[model samples]
Each structure stands twice: as C-alpha cells, then as structure tokens.
Target: MKRQHSMPFGAEAVHGGGVRFRLWAPGVATITLQLDGDQELPMTAADGGWFELTVASAQAGSRYLFRLPDGLLVPDPVSRFNPDDIHGASEVVAPTAFDWSDGDWRGRPWHEAVIYELHLGSFTASGDFAGAIERLDYLVELGVTAIEIMPVADFPGRCNWGYDGVLPFAPDAAYGRPEDFKRLIDAAHQRGLMVLLDVVYNHFGPEGNYLHAYAPDFFNPRHATPWGAAINFDGEGSRVVRDFFVHNVLYWLEEFHLDGLRLDAIHAICDDSTPDIIEELAAAFKSVPGRARHVHMVLENERNQARYLTRDDFGRLLHGTAQWNDDIHHAFHVLATGESDGYYVDYAADPARLLGRCLTEGFAYQGEASTFAHGERRGEASAHLPPAAFINFLQNHDQIGNRAFGERLCHLASPLAMEAVTAVLLLAPQPPLLFMGEEFAAAQPFLFFCDFGPELAQAVTEGRRREFSRFARFADPAVRESIPDPNAPATFETCALDWSAIERAPHRAVLELHRQLLLLRHQWIVPRLAGMDNGDPRLAMPSARTLAITWRLGDGSLLALLANLGDDPVDATPPPGQLLFATANLDATTLARGRLPAWSVRWHLQPGDSR
Candidate 1:
C-alpha cells in the first residue's frame, strides 16, 4: 500500500507484522539500517529522496539507527522516541497504542483561555512528566483553561530550556518516555484543561544538531538566527525542509492530540516565502480532517505582528491567532518596579503614557520608531484586532529568566505593585498567562539553566554573564560570581517551584488572591468582555501610578477596577451599587466614602442603573 501522505515521516507500525522504516536522504546514494544490534537491512529507494524497508521481526520498542556511507550511525530525525538520547538508536513508536481518556474534550475558546506557562523540568520537585501530572489538580483549581508547557524537544544533556532540541518529533528522554508525557496531557484533558506545547522552529540548538550532517540543505547558510543557522524555508531544497516542519505540526496535533501549540520567537524565523511559512504552517494544521474544536495557535513574535490574527485586504495571512502582548508586560514592569534599563528604557521613559496606550492602543510602539532599536519602527497597529488576540502576562519565562538573577516580579517589586498589576492582567480584556509558581509568589528564582559539554558549557556561562553586564545587578563586584552559570546543574535544580511555599503566610495569601482573580476572570470578566474590542474596555489613569478600567456588561451591570501601582496613596470614587471585590481593606460602606488607599486594587459594580 502506498503510504498515507501524512502518516508521519519516520517509522510506521505494521498492523499484523512489524515496523516499517522510512528514511529521507536525497543527498546520500546508499542507506543501510542497523537493526537489533547486529542485523543490517538495506532499504529500497523510493520517491522524494526516500528509502523504506519493513522488517517483520522488528516489533514496537525495537531500536535502530540509519548508517551513512562513511559508517556513522544517526538517530532518525523524525523518531518518536530516542531511548538512548540523540546519539543512540531511535525506537519504533506506535503513537496510537496509548489509551487516551480526553474523549470529546474539544478545548475551550481562545477568549476564555487563561494560560499557565510551565517548564516540566523545573515545575515540580521531581522535574519529570509524572511530577507535573501530580500538579494538574492544583492548576485546575487555579482556574487556568490552558497549560502552555515549555519546549520538550530532545536536546543534548539532562537539563535544558528545551529550545536546543534538534529532534522535533521526539519527547526529551529526561522527561521520561514518550508515553509519560502523553499520560500527563491525557490527564490534563480529562480535567478540561487544554495542553499547549511551546515549539521552537526558527533554528535548532547548536549542540547535537546533526541535521546538517545528513541533509546539509536542511539549514540555509544565507541567514542566521541568535541560535545559529536558520532553517531553510526559501532556499534550494527548501520545499522538503518546509514539509519536515509542517509534518511535525501535524504529528503533534494529530498524534499527541495536543490542544494547541505556541510558536516561539516567530520574528526570528527568516522566511521569504510569499504567503509566509507561518501561513503555510497554519493552513497545514487546519487541513487535518474532523477537527472538532478550535486548534489555538499563539505566537511570540517580538515584532508584535497582529497581522497573524487577521487576513489582509487581499485575503492573505492566517486569522484568529493570538500574539503575546509584550507591550503590556513591559509597561507593567516599568510602572511596577520603576527601574528601567536595556529594552525597558523605551517604555520606562514614558511609562504612564505607554501603560495607558498599551491598555487602549494595544501596542505602545505600534508603527512607531523604537528609541531602543535606534529609530527602527516596531510592530503594527493592532488595536483593531479583538482584545483576545493580545495575550497579557505579568511574568513569563523570558521576562523572569532573562534577568541577571532571575528574580521574580515579587522579589523585585513591592507586594502592592505586584498585586495591582496582577489584578490589571487578569481583569484586562486580553487573555492572561501565568508563569509557573507565579500564583503563590514562589521565592525560587527561575534562572537560565542548561546542560552542555564542558567546552560549550563554559562558552554559554561566559556569554550569559557577559550579556547581563549592562544590568546593575551584574555590575556589583560581589554579584559577578553570584550570577548563576547557565550550564550548572545547580542552576537547573534551583529553578524548581517550591510546592511547600503555598503553605506559608504571604504566599498563601497571594495564592488565594490569584485563585480569586482567575475565577473572577473565567466567571465574570471574560464573559463580559467576550468579543469586545480595545475600545470597549475603558481606561483612565488618574495619576501616573493609578489606573482604572471600567467594563459595561451585556447584562447592564457596570464593573470598574482601580489599582494604585505606586508607593503613594491614590483615590478613585466608586460608582456604587456594591463593592464586589477589594485587594485591600474596604467594603461597600467604605467604598462609598469616595477614596481608595494607595497601592490597592478594588472592584466596584453598579447593576447598570437597572431602571
């Protein structure tokens, strides 16, 4: 039988026989499969630089690697499981063998999504798939609709942020077997939680990246990314390269049954294709038949391209996608901490104005010349896009981990400021994302950590610390040695979230506060702001540090939230029917007194003048 055009690229499990192996090596003349340690089976050449061979003796979990002409063995680029890491044999996996319990769990709508981003390695004390699975209930109770897991691609070594993965098709062996991750996702889906994986497509990691060794055309040497060679999307032999990436997308969604994928650093993806690689990828994802629910795909484009969410006049670009709202985070960080340097300088210069604009205009630098980028215009006006297209977050992996010490917002900013910003984030019309341990205000720092060879490791350490030299923290002579080495096991170990912290005093308070805000978001705010534009959500900054956003509900109820983000006291008169919520001391009677305490968030509601 001819292979199904989309039946994945590597190994296929035969129904009554064994495993059929497929290898794409257009450049190589002859290919041999080293099977079951000793037996060598020569593969027959097929179309499109493809070679295939079926060994009836080889069963599921059997390991093998393709042998090159010079006699070097390499794991399958599209292997579902690499039992012995990247340098070892790739195991034949039957993706359909697992019993999934997420029956008919057609995921929630994007506007209703409250995403919690987590790194599986550092999210739990065990730092594995099962460890993360144990926390599913904790996350569900926290009222998050989506769990955006950090990248899980099999990279070199035991610990990593996962972006360095060369194997796009396999789960990291460090996180346990591929089935373990499936179990976690199944469990999450059983609880009505959507699982979204963060996928890196711009460039493969430097270490253990042998794609060039076999398929030298996989990467276009013409372009470069921060991570090194960019994936060839428009150059010669780019068609197959594009198919490889697009195939991975189909495999993740169809095989793993993941609810969605978050594309990482899409701005760094240098593709000159007419419709754009993203549009092509989106079309391929949507092409899968019998997709019941919305397959939510979000993007982290530094350019803040809202065009991804909507088609153009010529009916191009993918529509209904969400983009990360860095403007909101930058404005919040600057306004909350009052310490601005580096890229923060741009927003810090006019924080109040930028914060106001971020709330109202979507992107503060929308089509405006970026002073930080040396007069380069950044982003496009996306205020016309639905507010849900903008994902708001107070802290994400990049923001917290990029810092010299990886000190969380709670560590750097006042409790009041954090609380106020938290309220703003959850209450905003945009869908909100929470970093792992952020809800409980976990004290553990989320430092950048990785595991690489000694030589490359040293380079990473030196480069990481050097990048932070501009920061005031790294400037302190005492702090230079304190900068956590990215390559150290200790750095990876320390980033694990302390589950015990939730039992403590202020941490407990913060957790409860987060739960309440998230519940309020799902129940009241999201429904109220559903399909609402940025213009629908009204904002007022009474002072440089005080902000109030009012929403007129469809049910004729008015909801107003005021937050004081500064040390000084600020006041806002409540339009009272009742004071529904308050992050500080005050009640309906106190709210009626016409003043708000400094550094506080309060919600006031009047049943929309029921007359």
Candidate 2:
C-alpha cells in the first residue's frame, strides 16, 4: 500500500515546463515516445518494465503515443485524454485549465444521500456532459442530492453502457472534451449537487484494450472474470496493476473534483488474498486530500458482504463501503409483479417473508443456501449492519435494461402497484436511488446497446440470446428477432429519454408524486435515520403485508410511512396523527376511517408524539 514517489507514468507537465513521458513495458528491447509535432525519442530504462523520458519543449494540447517493442504505436494505457478515439493517439490535457468555484462546498453526509443514477448518453439528446449540465438545477429541484453517473470512461464504440470502457483514465470521446466534463462538475457543485462516477475495475473491454501489449502481466491468466481475465491483484506484476488502479481512484477524486464513486460489480473482481483490492481501494480513497478524502465509496456486490458497508468506531467506511442491496429488488419484484422467473424464483417462494426480511435485515441471504446459486451458501452474517448500508432501488440500469425487452416497472405492474412499490423505495430508511426518467415515468426502454464490428456484433447478439434463453420469452425465435439488435443505432437512440413527456399528464402526475414523496423524505425521514441498523425493525408485518415505521426527527416530531403491499384492502387504524401524505387519492372519510386501498401507502406526522 506504499505510494510511489517517482514521476507518474502517463504524460505529465513538469513543474517548470515541458512534459515528462513514462510507460511500464517489461521485457521490451526498446521503447520510444513520439510527440505529435516532435521527433520520436527513445525512452530510458529504469526499473522492471519502467521507461521514462522528459521533453523540455513538449507543449500542452499535443497528442502522443508510445512505440512498443514490436514497433506498434499504442495509446498510453493511463491516458488522460483521447482526442481521436479509444484506438487513436492520446492528447495532453492541462488539468488546471478550468476555474472551479466550489471553494466552500463540503458536501452532505452519506446517510443523507438521495442518488439519481443516469447514463450521460441517454440522459439528454446531446448525450454529453455539457448537455447534462443544463439539467443540474432540475435535479436540485427534484430533491436528488447526488448524481451517480454511469461509466464515462473511453470505450471502443460511440454507443455503449460504458461497462466496456477500455481506457479507464480517459473520458469517452463521444462526450465533450475533458474541459467540458469539468464544467459540468463545476456547475453541479454550484447547483448543490454531488457527482458520483461509476467505475468498472473488474475487467477491461474486449476491444481497444492495449494493456497486454505494454504490460502482459496486467491481468491474471489463471483467474477468469465474467467479462474476461481477472485483474492481477495478487499474482506476479500485481504490484504495478494494483497501484495503477488505486492511483486511478485517487486521480478521479482529486483531478476530476468528483464527490464520490460507485464501483461496478466488485463481486466479479476475484481476489482471495487478505486486504482485498476493495479494502485497498477504500483505504486509498480515504487517504486522498481535499474533498476527495471524505468522499463516498459505494459498491455493487451480489454477495451482500455487509462487512464492507459497516462503519468503524468513528462512523467512517475508511476500509470498506456501502453495497447495493439486490435482495430488496429481488424480493420487491416478486412481491410487486409476481415475476418468479430467473433469479426472482428464490424470493417468489416466500415474498412476503423475504421482503419483510429485506426490510428488517440489511441482507436477506446472510449465509443462507441460495437456490439461485444451485444450493450454494452465499453472503455472510450482516444482521448487525445499518439500513443506510444497503441501497434499495426498484429500477436501476440493470434492473430495467437487463430484461428480455428492457421493460420498465411502469409497464409491468399496475399504476397502483408502481406507486405502492415506490413508497417502499422512497420511504425506507435505506438510501434510495432513482434511475433517470423513472421520476417522470418516461416511455424509453434502456435496452442493451453497443457498437462493434459485424462479426463481434453478431457474436454478441448470439451470446445475448444464449444468456436470455433461460427466460421463456427469449425461448422463441420470433421473440428473439424482436429483441432489438445491440449494435443497432436505433437501439441506443430509442433509450434516449423523451424529455417532452414531463410537461404532459400521467407523466406529470408521476413526477409530482416523486417530488411530494422526496419532499416528505427530506422533511421527515433522513434526519431520524441515525443509529438505525438491521434487526431494528420498528415495524414489520409479513402476514398482513403491512408496515409502520416511526422515527423522531430533530425537532421531536414523529414521522411514519404506513403501507399496504398486497392487493387486498384492509382497515389500517393508523395511530392518532396528522395525515401528511398519501399515495392514492383518498377521500376524507377514507382517511378518517384509516382505510388502506389495494396497494397503497401513506405518511403521517405527529407533532408532539415521541414514541
């Protein structure tokens, strides 16, 4: 975990003048650095695989590429800017060019985070950071404290989920330049919004990844991940690769001025050694300076490892961090729509009990043998973890886009059911994340789309069919043809949200519902979530499909969300309190009788009651 004190590997501007070029290429007989407007210079050898050269006349905004041992010119592996594209030369970016005005912004605590996850490509028609900047005020108005952007790292194609990003350090060329991206961050901070980037560390993209050419040991040959070879965290040459990634995390926080990071699929990052890369990353990020030091670190892990989500005695996730709670989504999906297919089969068996458990415990599995994993025991004991440690969401990028047809929950369930499920999502003590366009119930379907060569694209199509073959819909050839080609431009274009719908009905109603609910959350729930943990369910009613959670606010008022998750209506007989909000349009007599309609919920506030 020792920090390297030598010059950085990529092209960096020296303190006085010019740029210092460095690369890590072991076993190479020769390595050369070629600037855009300058002659090719041979790099001097340092330690194992390390090559360095300093050009006293190198200027900013110039492009460069490294010549490999075999004479193949390759882009810098840790490039800051790739002006041409992922497969082209890397550009020199002056990091201090943009003037930031977030001098006094310290950011809100993690518990108070209300995340809005959105893909920059699909967030607006322009599909760039500059376009997203126009909506920062809209997000602030929508009550989202943080914007968890999907991966923006440079990938091979123009259209992708960004999971296939090859250059981890370079922003996507499809988006505006690095300076434009920085302007978006600066604007977001000015509008009182935190930006959390989603980073992919599990595997590099299949195409445009040239790390193996320069550093053949960057990936572990023995270990395979879902996307490809596992990163060489504990193997030979791991020190360089591990340090490379650790420094990248710090680089994003420090250089980009980001408020936090949401790590993508860490469970796929297989590391069997002590002080795992996750632990290493968390510790490194915690040690960063400025706003980067106390920035948020979130994980997407299926294993439900609550140990990462737990805070130390000082209430800090210094060595571990918060994880996405799939248990809640799986359980809620089964309860809301009765979709028992695929992974939903496990929770469908006893959805009420499962949902209740997910509500009470941070993880529903918690070392239990999972039928989905072929009776293999998964997860660890996590009943002691806090609710804030688990992020509950009804629809995220995967939940909506990974389906056979990429249908939203609004299309799957009844309107009443959607609202009811949303209450559980927004009103829960756990941090809630809303996917873009869901607040307004946009009709766009976020299908899995990409752009690749015909051969690889066909292979991906066939592979997708094989992947979804487990579902009955994909079992038919006709349905498979209608499944939308991932490489088609139309597939990506269709996912772009139709912002016009927000000004219309039904959508406006849904949007207003979200606003009201979030306003209620900010006014009631977030302040009272302190010291709340798993197995501390103040209200749990599995059999009746009902729940009542009461909490005392900073001013001593009690707030609660009384909910009915089932289709059968029942007499709630709520506690004596003032009715603050209701999901359904209830009449006065119904409110007086405390009658809960099928799939409905309500919020109540008691001014003087503390119990």
lDDT of 1 by residue, 113-211 (tens): 899999999998788899988999999999988999999999889989988897988999999988898889888988989999999999888787776
Q: What stretches of model 1 exceed 4 Å from their correct place?
A: 1-8, 311-317, 472-478, 533-535, 551-559, 575-578, 585-590, 605-611
lDDT for each residue of candidate 2 in 291-397, tens digit (9 for 90 to 100): 43348889998887777777666555655557788898988888789899888878877776677677667788998888888998888887667677788888899
Clashes of 1: 0
lDDT of 2 at 239: 83
Which candidate achieves the best lDDT against the true structure?
A: 2
Model 1 global lDDT (CA atoms, 0 to 1): 0.81
Error of 1 at 230 (Å): 1.6
lDDT, candidate 1, at 124: 88
